[model samples]
Target: MLHPSLAFEKGVPSDATAIPMPPPAPPPRPVDLPGVAPAASTGETPRPPERPAELSRSAPAGPDAARPAQTVKEDGKAGPSDEAAKAGETVKPTASGEIPVPPPRPADLSGSPLAVTVAPLDDSACRARLERLGARFEALPAISNGQCGAARPLKLTALADEIALTPPATLVCETAEALARWTTEAQVAATRDLGQPLKSLSIGTSYECRGQNHDPDAKLSEHSFANGVDVMAFGFAGRATISVMPATEGTPEATFLTAVRGRACDFFRTVLGPGSDAAHANHLHLDERQRNAGHRLCQ
Candidate 1:
């Protein structure tokens, strides 16, 4: 039997304290917190603030702000802390506006001078060219088909006189100059026969270093060295008759002889025919007197 003034209320919560009420449930924290910090009284946020969001149990918070509030993104977090940029570390902007810089461009090359020169002939190279040309060098008086002998001055008087008696017939040439001229011409004519090689020369009558008329006592003649020329045949005339004499009246032999003899005067310094002498009846001969080396008549 409780009186009206002293009795407790009928449905009062069991956990209620007497004087003051505690706060509702608090946010979770990493540690046993002492107390919450006082919120800013200035009404502005410290970091870049997110949009005003509705209080939610289903949505995220604070992650949407990509940068700080006041400073630009680059100046804000890009490099060392604010202390290092002040220490002169050469920081620069990239095209993408990140921290590290790109490398520099190269310089120009338009003003340089350039040239090419061939190396000169060495001993080995010169020997190679000579060997390829079939040049054989010898001391002195070396015999038969030697290079120097082929280039020698004429020594035999009879050989020279005999050569002087007529113009070469059929591809004949006299002087070394003339011979060199005829050399290529003769080759062009000879090689048309097919399959044969181009040889250096087969000059049948270069000057002969022989005694004059086989006479050792005679004055040194043009044939003493190898300067005079006697033409034998052209293009395997071995198979053809080499004619330089008088005609058999008016036969084709006469016409053929005349035609070939005319080609001779083109190359010889002196030209002769059967009318020149009995010894010249068989073949036409030619030589370079240098004085009389263009063309002489045998009439």
Candidate 2:
């Protein structure tokens, strides 16, 4: 028994002397992919790009790396600016395949001083004939400054609507003379034919030399601009007739108005008569804007 116990003690000493094994070599790290090393991830456990998008291998990650890392081709090319590539919409290039340009602004319509176009030559012979006919003006002045740039033009248009007369601006002087002449002839002829002896030819209105339709603080009227005029009527035999919008049916007051209005077409650019409108029911509306612009015959 004593011998047996001694032998067991000897066996353990041999095993105790044996060398220990190294830890299992870590599984060889999986091979690294070509480029897509995980980007500087803002850690949300990256959704692992719907596709592990691979950019141009030649174009590496850098300042001039075409575009943002996540972005693909824009319009089949690489660029910055949102305009270069709209988000939810397709950019249709022009027929020439050029980028579309914006339209010109209203400010661009302003004529340049250096490129100003001189007005066409004036007709001297016509001017002389008009001078003999008591022609009053060479050219009416342009709109005043206080008036709105846009609104003042409307005044010119309104006057045109009144006259039943649309003549070239160059012929406006002759047009005015003709207007005055016809008005004179009508009153005279009406006096002769209607046996309406002359009394007083009152002026209900005339060119005021102001802006159009604007009676600003009663400070200025389009008439004041000399762009408009108003006529009250002609005096006839026995009675002074308020002829413009004469409500009296079939009388010389009415006939004279009718004839004058009919003839007015030949004079003014526009013509408003007694039957034309309520505002003009008391007077004639006349002016020259443009031939065939907007002619309203307001009584």
Candidate 3:
């Protein structure tokens, strides 16, 4: 019942005024990735995307590129980061990295110098040094009194260049060495200020098992251990004796005394002279008593 020109295709309704066709699918769309170029129609494997310009610049380049980063350690070494240290893992440095060196800790930053425990004294070596310094000394039997005595004492009679220790000093080798070294300096001061070379050291107390300043209840003196000496006066070859008592200001004796007392501090851990205290007003007291943190007593 339809004309040849108006016949509908299969599945179309015969009574419809017009018929609709299914739309064709859109052409395949190319992906638009961030920081990536659109694929080329040529399709040469669509070259792999590159790192963004900003990201590429963020990496370190050139000679230091391979060097490992450094972090400060608590002990003042340069090594790994704190997190790495906490994990207890060892990170080997890259070939380009230098071996890390620990920096020296400054004394002021630490409030004091590093603590060094005193080593046991080497007696033979000390005696050899004493001999080389031209001191005449002999070992004395060990003296052991209650809370006082020298384990290895020495009888020191003279110092370098025949400078006498009047009444022979009973001391330790270490003390003798200190005295000899100090005497050498004294001789220089004598010639310069007093116009003569030192002839003798009028020794007051070399080794006595008594309390400090001769007090019966106070702490024992360094002399109890043969570690201290009291120089009552300095005798020169031809100049008048200069006692340790106070001298006239601006006089050569005063200048010499000041210079020698100051120099004694360099060689002795303790140096007490006139004006230090009533107990030590008449003589120069030099000793090698070790104190905490290398503290010195130079009053």
Candidate 4:
């Protein structure tokens, strides 16, 4: 009953009211976007799609261009700071978009304080003290033998009250002061126990460049620095000489020797005597060597 031309134009029979277009696939339900609410559930109006990352990046850059989004973690947290810090390297970008290089690490200067060279201290005040102690001395040229040396060595010939030092001795001002002080004690002991005045001291070693106890492999002796002395015997003005050997236990020589040796510890940091060890069995070893906590070695 429908005309052919009309049927062709309408693409349906005239008796049919309409030709159904395959139901437009229920306009594909929109997928959920992160951090954004769905229009149907949130009562919000639909909007255009966001600009793609690729399009945003391809756009011409300007001073007002948006910065790239920070990377997100698996748990949706923000990433690290703009400057990425790594071992020995720090990466940061400048306004011109160039990454800057980090500074170099400092070199190690870790070593012993003793290894560093230092200026010697002025010895004027020490020399002044020695003069006040009634010590007769004259300065000698500096002694330099590798690690064995003295900045200011003195040639000491006499101590307080003119108690002579036989054959003179090489010493620093400090050791000379200690020797002078100890000699006064020995003079007192000699007058009290030996019934005579102290006259001279028979010197043994002073300022020797050698190790302790004459051992080449041992630690350097205080004498290496002109800081030690060795007394071989004591000569009195009227009485017979008293050697540093062990005397009779009940004799006045023993009493005088004991008194002098015990008092030497007051002025010297180290005092070794005839009974201390075999190395010091025949004499007294006195020194001004420094020690920790002001400790002394008296044996």
Each model's C-alpha lDDT?
0.41, 0.48, 0.84, 0.84
User: Scored by Cα lDDT, where does model 2 land?
Assistant: 0.48
Q: Please list the Cα RMSD from the true structure of every candidate, rounded to 1 decimal place.
A: 29.6, 21.5, 22.3, 20.3
Regions more than 4 Å wrong, model 1: 1-205, 211-220, 232-240, 292-299
Best by the TM-score measure: 4
lDDT of 3 by residue, 1-299 (tens): 77534565544456554667799999866665445445577645456579787554332468865555456566667765444355443344558875444455576787666799554466999899999999999888888898788788999999998999898999988889999999999989998988889899999999999999999999989999999999999988776889999999999999999999999999999999899999999999999999999999999
Tens-place lDDT per residue, model 1, 1-299, is 54433344653433433356688887788586665455579654445567566542222236833322221233344324243244322344468975552232235544555578444223344334333433332212323443223322222211111122122211211244444443444344334432232232223444455553446676543444444555543333234433444668666456545654565566655555566666455555555445644335533
Q: Which pairs clash (backbone N, Cα, C closer than 3 Å) in model 4?
A: none
Better by TM-score, candidate 4 or 2: 4
lDDT of 4 by residue, 1-299 (tens): 65766786867655455566676556755566455566777788678989987554332258623444233344557554343422222334579885444333344644544567677778889889888888899999999999999988999999888889998999998889889888988988988898899999999999999999999999999999999999999998787889999999999999999999999999999999887999999999999999999999999
Evaluation by TM-score, superior candidate among 1 and 4 = 4
Candidate 2 stretches with Cα past 4 Å from truth are 1-127, 134-143, 146-172, 196-201, 208-225, 236-243, 292-299
Model 2 Cα lDDT, one tens digit per residue, 200-261: 44455454344434434554543443444565665444765555555577665666667777
Q: Predict model 4's lDDT versus the native.
A: 0.84
Model 4 collision count: 0
